[model samples]
Structures are given as structure tokens and as C-alpha cells.
Target: MKKYTLLLVLFFALTNAFAQVKTQYFDENWKPVIQEDMVYYRPEPKAVNGKYLFKDYYKSGKLQFEGFSLSKTEEKFDGEVKYFAENGKISGTSEFRNGVLDGSVKTYFEDGRLRQDATVKNGEEESAVLYTYKGTDINGSLSLYDLMTFFDHDERVKQIIYDGDPKGIRQESYLSEGKAKYYGPDGKLLGELIFDLYGNPNNGTMIEFDFNPMKVSATRVFVDGKEQQLEKI
Candidate 1:
């Protein structure tokens, strides 16, 4: 990458400030990598006071992301991480508290207009995200379940993916009848779903909550399998 050469020139200039800035390489999956297979790289030159830098760049030399990873493995991202577009504009930023997103996650348009402003607390969306859906502000425009499905949050629904899987590991409820109760990782009640014999949601309410205060965020009502409306609380 042409940017690799430019980094070399800059690297030598700052050699004195860095105790040892090893350029760690990673593949698309962020696994430990060699230069030949790298899609991202970061030279955590040094830590000041107590914070270490976690800056990643694309092979093209354009900035990719600047953030704080809890460890060199880059697994537990615990702070605000700003992602950049190819043209170097900040595309988005996410706030994480020890790996779980717990605050504002925002994205922007290329012209620098706010695209989506959603708040997440302890990994759950609360309230409606203000966004221009097809060029109009869709604030309070969709129900919680609608917004969840819109952002693909249903993928997190628990399912019976394996035999004898632990309660914390199930993906989606496979109960073919009656009601099913879902619990959060903290063992708190999350929601309930009433499935018909055909394994479709027949009647019930799906809920979202703010974890810290342990309060209901928004609710979606379903009657005879037809969705009702969103109730923001």
C-alpha cells in the first residue's frame, strides 16, 4: 500500500517518542495477521498517562477507525470509536461500555448531515431514532418492534440452535405453543411471546427496556397476530 510507505517515513520521525510501536496487522476478521494478509493495521506507539491508543487504518492509507479497544486482541471495544469514510469523513461513532453498546450511536451522510441518531443503553435501543427515511425525518414514526426489525434486531432473538444449549446461549424461542418468556443476560425478564401451534407469534407484547434503570423503553402490541402500534414510555 502506498500509505505503508508514507507511514514508514512518519514512523521514523516519531521513533524517539515511542518506546516501541509495533505495527500489528489484522485480516478482515481482526485476527492477528502478517503484512501480506492485512486489511487493517495499528501501531499503538505508546500510552500516555493511562490510556492506550487504538487507531486502525486501511491498507490504502485512508483512515479507517480511531477507537479504544480494551486489549490488544481488539475484542472488547469499551469506549467511543469513530469510523471514517474512504474520503476521510467521519462516517459514524459508537459508544460502548465494556463491549456492550451503552450510549449514543450515530451515523452521518456524506455531506455531513445527521443520518441516524439512536440511543442504546446496555445494548438495547430506547425510544425512536430520529432519521431521514427516504429524505424525511421519521421521528416517532415507527413502533419499537418496527424499528427493531428495521435495524435487524430480530437476529438477536433467542432460538433453539442446539440440543441442551444453556439458557444464555439460545438464539430464538422454538416453543410451538403457548407463551415463552425471554430473559436478559442479567437474568431479568426481557419480554414474552405467545406462539401458536404453527410457531408464529399469535398474540402478545414484545418489550424493550433501559437496563441501568431497569425501565421499559418501548412496547409493541400484537393482537391475533396483527401488529398494533408503538407505545413509547
Candidate 2:
């Protein structure tokens, strides 16, 4: 019985030495506080000037979260918050200043690949981004099916399809330009054949024009291709 009592006392001593404080803070009147038994008290001030900080830990003693606060206000200034994998590699980081999130936040996958990046301004989500399929660039050409922008509920700013490509065959549209347009074998506009102000085709605009009388020809006109002002002669 004496030996059992000594072992119980030793167990309590070791437990007391290791049971970290889960939460700590100050009272409304700026008094030093400590919490045990799910209750708080104005304990004798230990450490520096009434500034309260709290730390939580994993069962293994690895820090889970920590932050600071002033006594009289309801604001918390998180210096740095980190999450870790079970194997101890850092999995995430979030930084705050004066209670505002103002730094980069990153999260990593279990294999340590960057999973997400988010930007926070004043604790609001300014931008949250994700990445996928590392080491590859997006391929394929732009087409009319893709929306260029949105104007309103009914009016959509879409890519005007001419011969299927967004750039069109002659690469010309309602916008004003200083060049003549060109057409391809299928009578579809290809791109703008740039001409100097003196009406000479620039090298970039040089294209082969097949002079076949049997091929159907179209005229260039203003007002959404409605009124034919000029015809192919």
C-alpha cells in the first residue's frame, strides 16, 4: 500500500509537469487569468506585461495552433498558424497581423505537392486558387463556343464565329482596322491582309488568291453584311 501511494504521487507529478495549458487569456479588467477544471481565474501574473497568448498542442506535444490577444479588446493577432501531417511535415500555413489575414496561405497534399493557394484581405477571401496536372500547359485553339465575356443577362459578349475559329478566316470583324481582309478556298474569311495606307498589301497579309471563275464570290459591305456596296469583279 505504501509503494502504491508513492507510485500514484509520482504519476501525478509527471502528469502535472506535462499537461500543457489548452487555453489562456485575461479577464475583462485586464487581469492575468488561468483556466483549469473548465473555469478561469485571475492567477498571479507570470511572463510579460498582461499580454495574453494561447497555445494548443497535438497529443504528441507538436503545436497545433497558437495566437495572441490584448486584454480589453475582442481581437486576436495570430502571428503564424501551421498545420502538420502526422509524419510531422508542415501541411499548411496561415499568417495574420493585428487580427487581419495579410499574408500568403498555402496548403500541401500528403505527397507534399502544393494543393491550393489563397489570398486573404482583412479576413475575407479575396482570391482562392487551385492547380491541377502539374508540368503541362493548356492546349487547343480558342473557338466560338467559349465565352469571351459577359455583358448582362441577355446580351453576351461572345466570340463571333467566322469559319469556326475565333480569329475567323479573314481574322476581321466589326472592329476598324487599316488592312484589307482575305478569304480562303472555302470562301470563308481567313485573316486580315494588312495593306499600307497607300493601299499596298503588307508582307504579313500576303496570301494566294485563286482566280477561278467557277468559284462563288461574295461582296464586302457595311451594316452587318446586309447591304452589298461592292462586289468581286
Candidate 3:
């Protein structure tokens, strides 16, 4: 009688275990499960308080991509996103916030060099500075310089320097009609002239001299004709 009771108890326990395993094989509708919604499916849904949460990976498991989903929202939230090289280095990492790129995005070359990095805001490119082995500008021209600045929208303002020194610069003043009138080098009036529409000299006067010899050597003023002014050095 003891042997028969023990066999009966073992049979009932095995049957109960089998029944529980079978129960885990069905969907919420009690249908045979072949797809993801089934309880026995691999990579099972991680839940908290009956709410679907994010996915986590074990150290032994290979995770190519991973992210999260907040409750009642379809957007994925903060996560550590990584891509691996075929030879086993980190190829890139793209950060995200609420399903939009809201931080820095970095990418590396195959040789483990930092190839590119950029800042993104809400999926829009805010400001990006790129580095490359061979890069070109808007005109499709390459340069050997390390840095270049461009002004594509505004008229370029040029200043003329005298004696190849910026400190000895010249000022170009315009008259009431937007015409260049007096030009001074290093705060001293060098010459005064008027220009036509084509920048040709009209009626004007110019005082020319030599400085190193310390002499008011020559003065030619053109009002209607060239007039020489005599002065002491």
C-alpha cells in the first residue's frame, strides 16, 4: 500500500507540471501560440505591474540593439545604443531621448579613429562640425588647410593695409552720395578724390610726398589742372 501511494503521488505531480507547461504555451485567447504575443515565446516581454517595459540583456547574451518604451507612449526613451565592428571595436553610439536624437552622436572609423561627431536636437541637425581624411566645401573643392571660414550670404568687407602692417591701416570715407571722398593712412590724410559711377577719378586733389627722406617733396592737386604746392620740409 505504501508503494502504490507513492506512485500515485508522483504521477499526479508529473501531470500537474505538464499541465502548467501546456498552459504557458497558449496566448491570452487560449489559442496555440506561434508568434510573439505567446507566453512561451523566446525573448519574452519584460513587464512591470502588468505594463510592458524595456528589454535588458545578460552578459552572456549578444545584444546588437536595445532601447525602451514608456507607458502609454510609443516613443523609446533613454538607452545606451551601440554598434560593434566586425573585428570587435565600438563603431558608433547614438544617444536618444523620447525617440528623438537630443544629444551627441559619434562614429568611428574601421581603424579606430574618431571620424565624426555632431550635436542633434529633437531629430534636427542644430550645428555640425565634421572632420575627414579628404573633405570638400560647397563648391566641391578640397583644401589642405586645417580650418576654413566662409561667408556665403554677406558682401565681403575689405580693408587696405599700408607697408604690409595692419596697424598702419587706411580708412575709406564716403560722401553724402555714398561716394568715397577722403582716404587716410594711419590717421593722416593721404589723398582726397571723388569718383564717378565706374570709380574713375573726377575733379579732385591729391597730395603726394616722401616720408623716409622727411621732405614735402611733391604736391600735385587736380582741381581743373595739376597745381603744385610749395612747402618747407
Q: What is the lDDT of residue 202 in candidate 1?
A: 72
| Model 2: per-residue Cα lDDT over 180-205, one tens digit each | 45555466654444444554444343
TM-score of 2: 0.35
Query: Poorest 10 consecutive residues of model 1 by lDDT?
Result: 143-152
Tell me the whole-model lDDT of each prediction, alpha carbons only.
Answer: 0.63, 0.48, 0.47
**Candidate 1: how large is its RMSD?**
15.2
Clashing pairs in 1: 157-171, 158-171, 158-172, 158-173, 159-171, 159-172
What tens digits encode model 3's per-residue C-alpha lDDT throughout 1-233? 99999999999999988644221233544455664455322243344553434432222333323445444234365544566554566777777776678787778878776656666778875554344432325367753222211111232222222222323423233433323333334456656656566654554654433433222344445553334453433
The regions of model 2 sitting more than 4 angstroms off are: 1-53, 66-75, 134-233
Q: How well does candidate 1 score on lDDT at residue 145?
A: 22
Which of the two candidates, 1 or 3, achieves a greater TM-score against the reference?
Answer: 1
On TM-score, the stronger of 1 and 2 is 1
Error of 1 at 46 (Å): 2.9
Give the C-alpha miss distance for residue 137 in model 1, angstroms. 16
TM-score for all models, in order of appearance: 0.45, 0.35, 0.34
